[model samples]
Target chain A: MATLSINSVRKSFGAVEVLNNIDIEVEDGGFLVLLGPSGCGKSTLLAIIAGLENSSGGDILIGDKNVNDVHPKDRNIAMVFQSYALYPTMPVRRNIGFGLEMRKVAPKDREAAVQRAAELLQIEHLLDRKPGQLSGGQRQRVAMGRAIVRNPDLFLFDEPLSNLDAKLRVEMRTEIKRLHDRLGTTTVYVTHDQVEALTLGTKVAVMKGGVIQQLADPETIYDRPANMFVAGFIGSPTMNFLKGTLEQGDGGLVLRHAAGTLALAGLQQDVAGFVGREVTAGIRPEMLDSGDGPASLTGVVDVVEPTGPDTMVIASVGGQLITARLGPKDRPRPGEPLTLTVDTTAINLFDPVSGNRI
Target chain B: MAATRSRSKLLWDVISYVVLVGLAFIAIAPIVWTFLTSLKFEEDIVTRTMQYIPSRITFENYVKLWNQSGYPVLVINSLIVTTTTVLLCLLTGTVAAYAFSRFQFKGRTQLMLGYLVVRMFPAVLMIIPLFIIMRQVGLLDSTIGLAIAYTSFLLPLFVWMLKGFFDAAPKELESAARIDGTTRLGAMFMVVIPIARNGLLATCVFVAIAAWNEFLFALMLTTSQGSRTWPVGLQLMVGEFQLPWGMLAAGGMISILPVIVLFAIVQRAMVAGLTAGAVKG
Candidate 1:
C-alpha cells in the first residue's frame, strides 16, 4: 500500500478544461472517495491518477516517485470499472488470473492466486463459468476478484456498485468495505452516490464544476460542509436554505426571513460582520423537533410524509416553505398549524451571494 | 378475444413463411440448376428445351474436363492466391482496425476517411495502373503477385468491417486488462481479439470470396499455366469456334465448391460479425 499525492493537476481537452488546478493527497491505507455529480471531472481525476488518462499539467506522486509519464501497466494499480468490464471470452478463473499471468507468474502460483481470490469472494463454484453466464452480482464479484488478485499499490474503483440492484448494491457495498478492511490497500474511489461516499470513504472530497468544494472526513463533511455546494451535495433530502438577513434584535441576533424570524443564540458571534446583510440559513431536515420548546417557530403544515421511523413535514409560513424531519408520532396533517423547535446550534450560515460559509 | 387474436397471429405466421420460402427458392434455384447442368451430357445441355432432371446422370464431363483442361492447376492457383490474400488482409486489417478503435492520435479521423475513400473507388478503375505496376515488378502471371495486389484492394474492406467489430467491443474490457498488467498491445490481443472472433472469421470469409471471384485483375495479370487462376482458366474454356458448355460448367462448379464449403463452416460467425455495430441485439 502506498499514499498518492496529486499536485495542482489540470486536464484540458483542446481549450475546454475538464479539471482545473486540483490538488489532493491520500494517506497510506486510506479510503479516499471523489464525490460529484456527472460531468464534474471526478472520473477524469481518477483516470488521471490511474495513468489511464494523462493530465495536461501536474505531478502524480505514488508513494514518493512521480508517475506522470508512467504507463498504466507499470503504475501497478488495479481499477474496477463501473461496468464490471470482465473478459467475456475467458472463464472466471482466467479472468482472475490474467494479471498474474501477464506479470509472468508461474502457472501453479497463478492458479493458487485465482483460487484464493475466488474463495475470498465466495465464488469458487463460478471459476469455470464465463462472464456472460454469471448474474450481475456474480459479475461484480468476479470483477473485484480480478482486481484483488493483483495486489496492486492502489485500488481505483469507478462506481463499482452502481450497476447492481438496490439490495445487491448494499450487499456489495458491505462486501467491498469488508474487503478493504481486510486488505487495507490505499484506494481512490469515484461515485456520484453520496451515501456510498459517506459509507465507504475515510476521506470524502466533494466536488463541483471541476473544483473541490470540500475535502474532509465523512462526519466532518456532513456536519461542517465548507460551502453551500458541499452542504447541498453531501446530504440526502438536502439541507433547506432559507434566504434571510442577520440582524441584532432583542437579547441577541436573529435571522429575519420573509416568512418569519429564527433567533440565533451562538451563531451571532461568528457572523457579526454579516449583520443586516442577506445570508442563507442552512438547517438539516433532522435538526427540527416537533415538541414545543424555548426555540420554536410557528408555521402551517403544507405536506406530511410518514416514513415509519420518522415523519417529513413541509411547512409554509408567510408564503415560504421549509421541510423539517420530526418523529412519526408528531406528524402534523396538511393545513394544520404547528410549532416546530429549530436546533439553533446545528444551523449553518452562508453568504447568500458567494455561497461561502459565514 | 384470445381465440381471434391467436387466429390472426397464425395467419400472419403463414403469410411470413410463404414470402420467405418464395424468396429462398428464387435464391437457391439457379445454384441447383447450375450443379445439375454440370453433370449433364454436352448434347443434353445445348438442346433448346429445358430438362428438369436428366434420365441418366454422368460424371464423364467432370473427368473429361479435369483430364483435358488445366483445371487442376487453375484450382490450385486460385486456392493459393485467395488463401494468401485472405490471410494477409486479416493480419494487416485487424491491427489497423484495433489502432483506429483504441487510439486518439492526431489525424485519426482523416486517416479513417482516407481508408473509406480507398474502398469507395471502383476496383476496375485501379486494374490498369495495378497491371502496369505488377508487370514492371516482373510479378505478372504469379500467384504471389496476384495475392499482394488483392491485399491492397481487400485490406480497406477488412479494416472497415473489423473496425466496426472492434468498436462494438467495450473499451473497458481492454482498459481492465491493461490495469491487470498487460501492455496495451497485449491487452488487445488477449482481450479484444478473442471477444471479436466472430468478426475476424466473417472478415476472412469476405476477403476470400472477393479474391476467389476476382476476374479482371486475374485475367490481365496472369498469362501462362504457371500463374493462371481458375476464373481466368474457366473463361478461356469458351473457345472461338464453339463454347465447351459441359467443361465450362464443370470448371465453374469446381471453382464455387470451396466458397460453399467455407460459408457452411462459418455461416453463423459470418452473420454475427457482418452485422456488428448495426444493432445492439
Candidate 2:
C-alpha cells in the first residue's frame, strides 16, 4: 500500500543505452503497467525498480524514501518473474514461507502467512508438491502465492501471464486483476501485450526505443495517443494510415490521397490551417462502415476475414489497402465493389514528416 | 513389400547389435580380465598362455597384499586425501562459482580467464615447482599436504565446471529469493545451492575421481606409505623381471571399486548435470 515513483531514470550497459530519461509514478494501490515490445527496456525498468539492476542515473522512490542505493531485500518489493521462478527443490509450502523465514519472522506467523496466501490463491492442496509436480498454471499461482505471502510494499510482475497458453493467460490475467483488486497493493507490471495493458492497468506507459512514448490511462492512450507510435501500437487490427495532402475542395477541406478524395466531414473545424500540406490520416478499422451514405469512400474489396462477431474487410482505395471491421453479415467478398463510409470525427491527423498528431 | 521392409529393419538391427556388442566387449574385457587375474593364484597368473578362468580361485593374493605390504596404508591415505580434496574443492568451488555466476564485479572476466588458464596448464608442468614448494614448506610426505596440493590443482576445474552450472541456473530464482528478503548470499545458499544439487554431486564425484587416480604429483611429492596414494603404491608391486601380477591386479581392483560404486549411485545426476548448462528451459 505504498506509492512507487521513478524519476528521470536512465540506464546503460557499457555504451548501449537501455532506458533513457524515464519518469513514472504509481499512486498508492494503483496498477501501473509498462507496455512495450521486446527489447524496449520495460523489463530493465522493472528490474531497476526491483533493485535487481542498477540504473545509470535517476532516483527510485518507494513510499517517499529514495531506494536507488537500497538492496533488493531492503527495498521490500516482491516480484513474480515471467518464468514463475519457484524454487524447484522446495515444496510449495517452503516456497511460500521462504520470504518470511528470510525476514526472521516467527515460525507460527510464517505458517499462518503461508496458509493465508495458499487459501487466497486457492493452492492449499498443492502445498506439499514441488514446482516440477505442478502444472504451469499451478506453478504460476504458487509463484504469485510466494509473492503475496511476503506482503511487501510493492508487487512487480514481469509478463507474468506470457508463459501460459492463450486461455490460461486470459484466466490468469483475470485472476491477477482480481488479486490486485483484493490486495490493493501498489503494483508495477511489465508486459509486451497491449491487451494486458489495456485490461489490467490503471495507468499504462507505452515505450519504444528505450524511451517513454506516452503514459496515460487506457482509454486516453487508445483514443488520443500522444504520437503516431502510441496510436499505432495501442490498437488491434491497427489503425490504417493514408499518406495524403489536405486541400480545400468544393465545399470544405478534403484529404487527397492517391486513389480518391475523402471529404473531411467534421475534421475541417479542427484541421482548417493544414490546407495543401501533406499529412497522414489515421482511421481505425472499426470506423469504416459499409453502408453508402454521406461521406462515403468507394473501394474494391480485397479480402474478408470473419472472426465470428464481426468481419474484417480489406478494401483497396486509390491502390491503398484499407481495412474495415464491419458486421459479419454485411461483409463484401473479394473483388466486390463496396462503399465504406468514413467516420471523420474519430479520424486522427499526423504530420507526415514528423509523425506528430496534428 | 511389408515383409521385405521388416526383413531389412531386422537386418539393420542385427548389424547395430553386432557393432555395439563388439565395442562393449572391447571396453569390458580389460576390466573383466583384471578382476579374474586378481582372483587367480600367483603361480597361475604367470602362465605363458592366457587362461580366462583359473583352476584354483583364491583370495590369498588380496589378503597377502593387504597385510604384507603398505597397500592398506596406501588405500587409507588415498581415501583421506581424495575425500579431503573433494570436500575442500567443493567448498571453494561453490563460493567462487556463485560469485562468478551471480555478480557483476570488476575484473570478473579477467578472473574467469585466469581460472581457465590455471585449468589449461598441464599437471606435469606444475609437478616440479609444486614439489619444490612442498619440500620448502616441509609438506613432502604428508597426506594432508597431498590433499592441499590436489585441491589447488583441482579447484580451478571444479570452479570452472560449477560456474557453468550456476550460470545456467536462472537468475530470476535468486532475484525472487532476494526480493523475498533474503540477502544475496542467503539467496545463493538457500535457493541456488538446492537447485544445483545435481551439479554439486556431479562436481564432487569428478573431483573425487581426479584425486583418486592422481599419480604424477603423488609420485613426485610423497616418499613413503604415510602419503603414498593408491596409484603410486600399486606401482611398487612391480619388479624389474617378475611382476606380482595378482597382487597388483588386486590393488588396482580395490582402487577402482569405490569410484565405480560412486558413479553408479550418481549416474543420472552426473549425466543430467553435465548437460544442464547447454539449454535454458
Candidate 3:
C-alpha cells in the first residue's frame, strides 16, 4: 500500500559495519527481494526498513513521510519472521487479532478482521489452537495471518520459508506469491535463495559483502549480470569463466586459452580496446548445446550426470572444468572428445582485472 | 564373558539399591522419630529407657502447644512476612531480570556482578547495619521490616533464575509483536511475560521457601512475639534449663506443614518450570 524508500542508509555494530550506505526504493505494490548468501547484510537492510533497527546515517520514508524517528508500531508495518515467531501461548485467533487489539479496534471489528484473514489463509479450523499444536506449514500460515490481519502499509518477510522442508518451501513460496498478487501490497522480502528471488521478486537486489552487486529485474539479472560476481552468483552449475586473451580475429573476436581458440560473436558492448588483453568469457550452462557451430569449444568429457530432464556434462577445457547442460540423450563417456555450440548472442565477456562486463 | 558381565551388573544394581536405601533412612529417620516423640506422654520421654514408640498416644502435646503457646500468631506472622517478601522479590526481580536479558547498557554486567557480590558475603555481616537502618526507619520489629531484609538477599537469586527463563524466550517474538503494533513495553507484557510465567511461578516458590524457613534474620530483627516468625518462636521455646521435648517436636512438625502443602500444590508446575529452558521446542 506504500512505497518504501531507503536513502544512503548505513548501519554499524560498534566498529564493524554491517550495512554500507544502502540505497533502495520500492514502488507501491512492487515486490523487492534482497537476495544474497549469509553475512551479506540483506536481513539487516530489511530490518532497517521495518524500523526495528536504526540506521547510522540516512533517512527511511514510508509512503511520503520520513519514518526514521518513528517507532515500529507507529510505522504501520507487518513482519513475518523466519521462525514464524508466533505467540506460543495464544490461540491462532488471538494471535491474528493481537495487532488490532493493540491498535484499540473494537471487539466485533477485530473478530471480523481476524476471521477474514483466517479464511484467506485457509486456517479457520486452526483458530482455536495454539502455535505449538500446529505443524511447520500451519505455523507459517498463522504467521502470515498475523501479518495480513493488520492490513499494514508494508509487508516484511525475513526468509519466512527457510525453515520448511524443500517441498513445503516451494509450496509456501507459491502461496506467498499468490497472496502478493491478490493483496498487491508493497513488500520487502529477504532470502539467500536465488530461485525464490527469481520467482517472487519484481526487482531483485543481489548483495555481497554488504554491497548491492546488482539491482535489476529477475530476467535482466539472470541474463545480463553487471559483474563477474553477479554472473557467478546468480546461476546454478554457475557460469563458466574462461580465462583467455581477447584477440581480433577474421569474423569478429576470438578468445585464445589453454583450450582451442573460440570465436566470440554478438559483441554487444565495445571491447575493441582490449584486443590483446586478458578477458574472462562467461557462459551459462544451459546455453551450451552438443554439436559443432560457428562459435564452439571442444574439450574431453570429465564427468556425466543425468538429472532426469537434463544431463550435466563436465568437461576439461584445457585445464579448467566447464559444465554444460545437454539433452538427456547426449551422454558422452569420460575422456571422449566433445564439441559444444555456444549461444554466442548470450555469451558475456568481462575484464579480467576488474571483473566488470565489457 | 557374558555370564561374568551379567553377574557384575546384578551386583552393581544390588549395591546401588543398598546405598540409596541407606541414604533414604538417614534422611527420614529424624522426621519419623520426631513424629513419634510428639505423640508420647511426658513420662515416656523423661524415662531412661529407649522408647522408640509411645505405649499410649496422646493429643495433649498438640492441644497444649496450640492453646497456651501463642503459636498461631507466629505462624500468621511468618505467612505475612513470606508473602510480602515473595511479592517484593517478584516485583523488582522480574523487571531487573528482563532488563538484563534484553538490554546492553553501559554497566549492566557490573551491576549484575554487584548483585552476586551481595550474596557472596556472610549474612551475619549485614545484620548490624540492617538492624540500625531498620531502627532509623521505624520498621525494626515489623513483619514488613523482616520481609525487606529477606528481599535484599533473595532478590539476587530470583533475578538470576528468572533471567535464564527470559533469555530462553525468543527475541524474534518480541520483534514480531512490535511490528504487529505494540510498543517495546507492550510487547514484553503481551508476549515475553506470558511465555515466562511458569518460570516466574517457580522462582516465587523458591523465594517463599527460603523466607519461610529463615531463622537467623527473623530472630535478630524481631523483638516481640507479635512480629516473630514461627522458626524464631520454635527456637525460643527451649527455656535455658527446661526443654519441653514433646512440645518442641510437635512445633517442628507443625512448622513444616505449610511447606509440605505448598510443594504438593505446585509440584508439577515447578518441575516443568525448572526444566523449561533445558530444551528447544
Candidate 4:
C-alpha cells in the first residue's frame, strides 16, 4: 500500500551505537526483510520502522510522509510480534477487532472486518476463544489476523514465526507469504533466520553490527553476496571460504593455495588489481561435485553426514574445513582423499584483508 | 540397595507430612480456638477448668457483642476505612507500578528505593509525625484521614507487589496495542491492566487486610466511636480489670469474617495470577 524509505537512520544507546547510519527502501507492495543474528539491530530497525522506538537520527518516510516524529498509532502500522502479543484476556474476535474499536469504528463494520480476517486465516471457529485457549499455531494465526484486519499501509512482523516449532514455523511462513500476496501490503519483516529471509523477502537487507551488509533480492544475495559476512551468513551448511592467493594464470585468474589451483572463470566483478594478492574464494556447498577434472580440488575427508537426499562431505583442504554437498550416493569415507569439481563460474572472490567481495 | 532407597523415600515423605501437618495446625489452631470461644457460654469461659470446648453452645456472646456495644459502628468504620484505603492505594499504586515497570526515566531506581525506604521505617515511628500532620490538616479523627494515613504506609507495599505483576505482563503486548491504534495510556488500560487484573485484585485484598487490622494509628488518631476501627474498638473493650473473653472472641471472629470471605472469593484467581508469568505465551 505504501513505500517505506529509511534514510540515514542512526540509533545509539549512550556511547555505543546500535544502528549506524542505515538506509533502506521498500517499494510499494514489496516485502523487505531485515535479517541478522541477535544483537545485530534487525529488531531495532523494525521497531524504528514501526515507530515504537525513535531513531537517534534520520527520516523514515512511509508513502512520502516523514514519520520520524509520528506516534506508532498515528503512523497507521500493525505489528505481529514473535510472541503473537494477542491480548490475553480478549477473545479472538475482539483481538482482531481491537484496532477498529480503538478507532471507534461502527460495531457492524468492525465485526465484518474481523469476520473477513478470521475467515481468511481459517480461524472463524476460534473467534469466541481466548488466546490462552489457542494452540501455538492457532495463536500465530490470531496474531496475523490481528494485523491483516487493521489493513494498515505497512505490515510489520518482528520474527513472528520464531515462537513456533519447526514444522509450524514453515507452515506459518507459507501462510504469511500467502497473506502478503493476497493483501499486497508493503511489509517489513525482521528475523534472524536466513531461510525466512530468503523465502519471504522481496528485498533482503542482510545486516551485521547495525549496518546493512547487502541489500538485494534473495537470489543475488545468495549467489553473489556483497562481502564475506553476508556470503557466510545467508546459506545453510554455510559457504566455504578457501584462503588462497589470486594469481594471473594462462587462461584468466586462478587461486593458488595449499591444496591446488582453482581456475576462477566468468567472474562478473573486476579483480585485476588483486592479482598475486591473497583473496578468499567463497564456494557454496552444493557447487562442489565429485570429479577428476583439471579444476578439481582434493582434500582428506574429515567428516561425512548423510541427510536423506544429500550427504555433506566436510573435508580438510589446506588445513581448512570445507563442506561439500554431494549426492546421497557419493558418500566418501572419513580419512579418504576426496576430489571435488568446483563450480568455477559461481565462485565468489573476496579481499582477505577487507573481507569485501572483489 | 533398591529396598533401602524405597525405605528412605517413604521416611522422607513421612517426615515432610509431619512437618507440614505441624505447620498447618500451628496456623489453624488459633482461629479454631477463637471460633470455639465465641460459641462458649460465659460460665464455661470463666470457669477455673481449661475447657477446650463449650459445655453449652450459645449465641449469647455474639448477640451481646452485636447489640450491647458500639461494635457494629466500629465494623462499619473499619469497612469504610479499608475500602477507602484499598481504593486509594490501587488508584495511586497501579500507575506508580506501571510507570516503574515500563519507563526508564532518570532517578527511577532511586525513586523505587525511596518507596522501599518509606516501608523500612517502623509504623510506630510514623505515628507522631502523621498525628501532627493530620491534626494540622483537621483530619485526625475521620475515616478518610485514617484511610489516607493507611495509604501512606500501605501504598509502597502495594506498589512493590503490583510492580512485580506489571513487570510480568509482556511489554510487547503494549507495543502491539500501540501499533493497533491505542495511545500509551489507552494501551495500558486495554491490554496491560486486563492482563494484570487478577494480580490487582490480590493486591487490593492484601492492602484491605492490612488496613482492616491496623491499630496503632487508629488508636492514636481517633477520639470518637464514629471514627475508631474494629481493632481499636476491640482493644478499648478490654477494660482495665474485665477481660470479657467471650465478647473478645466474638469480636475477633467478626473482624475476620470479611477477610475469610474475600480469600474464599479470590483464592483461585490469586493462585492463577501468581503462576501466570511462569511460562511464555
Give the top-scoring candidate (DockQ): 3
Compared with the true structure, what per-residue lDDT tens digits does model 4 show for residues B183-278?
898988889999899999888888999999999999999999999999999999989889998999999999999999999999998887777777
Instruction: Give the interface RMSD of each candidate.
Output: 0.7, 0.8, 0.7, 0.6
Residue A295 miss distance in model 3 (angstroms): 0.9
> For model 2, what is the alpha-carbon lDDT of residue A217?
95
lDDT, candidate 3, at B183: 82
Off by over 4 Å in 4: B1-20, B278-281
Q: What C-alpha lDDT, on a 0 to 100 scale, does residue A49 get in candidate 2?
A: 97
The alpha-carbon deviation from the true structure for residue A61 of candidate 3, after best TM-score superposition, in angstroms, is 0.5
TM-score of each: 0.96, 0.94, 0.98, 0.96
Better of 2 and 3 by lDDT: 3
For model 1, how does the per-residue alpha-carbon lDDT over A276-308 read when each residue is reduced to its tens digit? Answer: 999988889888888676566778999988888
- Per-residue lDDT of model 1, residues B143-249, tens digit only: 99999999997898899888888989999888888888888889889999998999999988989999999998899889999898998998887778989777777
User: Per-residue error at B210 for model 1, in Å?
Assistant: 0.9
Q: Clashing residue pairs in candidate 4, if any?
A: none
After superposition, the stretches of candidate 1 with alpha carbons farther than 4 Å from their true spots are B1-26, B276-281
Q: Candidate 3, residues B133-220: lDDT per residue as tens digits?
A: 9999999999999999999999999999999999999999999889888888888888999999889889999999999999999999
Candidate 3 per-residue lDDT over residues A324-345, each given as its tens digit: 9999899899999999999878
Best by TM-score: 3
